[model samples]
Target: MIKKFVFTISIPIVLFGCSVTTTPNGKQVDMLPLISDKNRYLIVDDKNLSKAEKLENYSNQLSEFYGKQNSAYIRVLPRPSYQTNDRFTPIPFMVYEIDSNPVKIFENTMFNPNNVRITEYAQHDLRIPIGKHDLIIVNGLGNSRWFTKIDDVNFEKDKKYVIGADVKKGQNAQIFIAEYEIDNRFKVVEPEHFIIKKKIIENIPIGNLKSVKVY
Candidate 1:
């Protein structure tokens, strides 16, 4: 009886000690670089500096980093792809890759939570090196089985750009990219939308970048 009790206890202990293997079998990918450090300068300002002077200083910083003609800022909007009646509604997109390099967006499982505000999860912005860049976007629906590729996007210097996608049910999604000039107040002004000439992918499976499950 003593041996049986010890054996039963050991079985549970062994099971508890065993680690569960989480094969990257989900759409959740690696985290993207947050805007905390990059955008911190936007909020913190000198008490004596005028708004125009501050903007000029920021512009100088951009010139120092990537030269005056080769730097641009881009912010990817957290716009919805499609809405479903399921638990996860209003599914937003994640940038999978840019210029053939993985964006590795930090996955936030919540479908745009209202009460819980995480700054990293809220913004998908990045300071991209200017020039032609290929972009790949994916959604966190159906385990990231959908994707779209935008190629050869030429980014010019001293411009602030915004990009977003809108998906229609059973149809191709439209990608909207707009450029704006920065004003003396450091605000984006003079909006201009770029016409997309690249082929718009409706949705496709992530074959190479996918995760497999193991039971």
Candidate 2:
């Protein structure tokens, strides 16, 4: 009968293609349901309006307020003719919070160790909080002159914090203080002779307490 109706229509097409569902090293599993109502109308509806939807709903409410807690400060200025130049020359800076992810923080020897020899103009400070950081400055061995500062700091938890300062370039400028640890988990524990090459600055709006100074 036509080979019994071609083996009964190929046995329900081989049992509906073997009713898929494998694993144990067989690999063939796709439960599929990754948000699909036409991709949920591409989000953004904050009650709906115009003007680009109230500017993307105030930019997602300032990206959830810096994505939660934020703070940063890194100021390093050394250019009294490179303070004798011998190597160390880093200048990378960053800050973020407005929506998280953009934290390389700062660089410039963390405010010291660039041949430690300053001759005047002085300022050093490294108070970091809010998240993501890395600052390095070094060229120390002879002439030095490093300065940095970012005000509005008031952090104390188990004490032990040094913002920034390292000088030795000319007229009686002797300052070297670059130690840290003000709670919120900022890093860069000493030892550096110029090696800053990681940077990421995005969103950034921690209530506009934005202070990013680099040189």
Candidate 3:
């Protein structure tokens, strides 16, 4: 079973000095492009660009990278749509670790239903190496902070997957990790439901930390 916990503590800023490399197969580059400008995968955060324009840029970029047969595309949609009561508020989340390695320091963007291109936001598509990876996700709900893990995910190359959540008032959030078949345009056209693997819900915690270092 996937375990979860919540704690109220100040998040500390910790510097992680490590080298992240990208190969021609689009492994590390697609996963953490924000680590450096040399990685062409970095999204150009032009505030002047309309939401549609930003999405178009991402679409075009994804289409161009479709030939990378060694990499898999994954998008995390914790707040896929507007909530009934919290329409404008952000559901902050962070991918703290991947395959036992600490994710390099990065900024988390507010959930914007309009801007579809992958930002540090919860709804962006990320390219990652094809293999079994253990992931840790930290998310916020109201005044509490919680975390969960997706372990032993065997991602295949050239496939697209979406990890989304179903949250309700006075209920624990249910998360689904679904795989999809993409078209020539790199858009998710059909849902391969059988490809989905794990399903879990949030749980309450019994302890708190003075401070947490997520980076």
Using lDDT as the measure, which candidate wins? Answer: 3
Poorest 10 consecutive residues by lDDT, candidate 1: 114-123
lDDT of 1 at 86: 51
Expressed as tens digits, the lDDT of each residue in 31-63 for candidate 3 is: 233244433333465655665565445433433
**lDDT by residue for model 2 over 1-215, one digit each (tens)?**
99999999999876554343343445332111111233212234343344343333322332333443443434333343334333453221211211222222111234343212221111123334433333222222222212221222343332223322333466433223232333224223222422333222222222122112121
TM-score per model over all chains: 0.41, 0.19, 0.43
Looking at model 3, the pairs that clash are none
- Error of model 3, residue 95, in angstroms: 3.1
Q: How far in Å is the alpha carbon of 9 misplaced in model 1?
A: 26
Off by over 4 Å in 3: 1-69, 78-88, 92-94, 104-120, 166-171, 181-215
Model 2 weakest lDDT span, ten residues long: 114-123
Model 1 Cα lDDT, one tens digit per residue, 1-215? 99999998898766544323222444343322212333222333444444344434433443344444656765545333231235454334444566555533222234533211222222324556788777665444433344555667777665656555556788655665556333344222111223334322323433334332211
The order by descending lDDT is 3, 1, 2
Misplaced by over 4 Å in model 2 are 1-67, 82-127, 130-164, 168-215
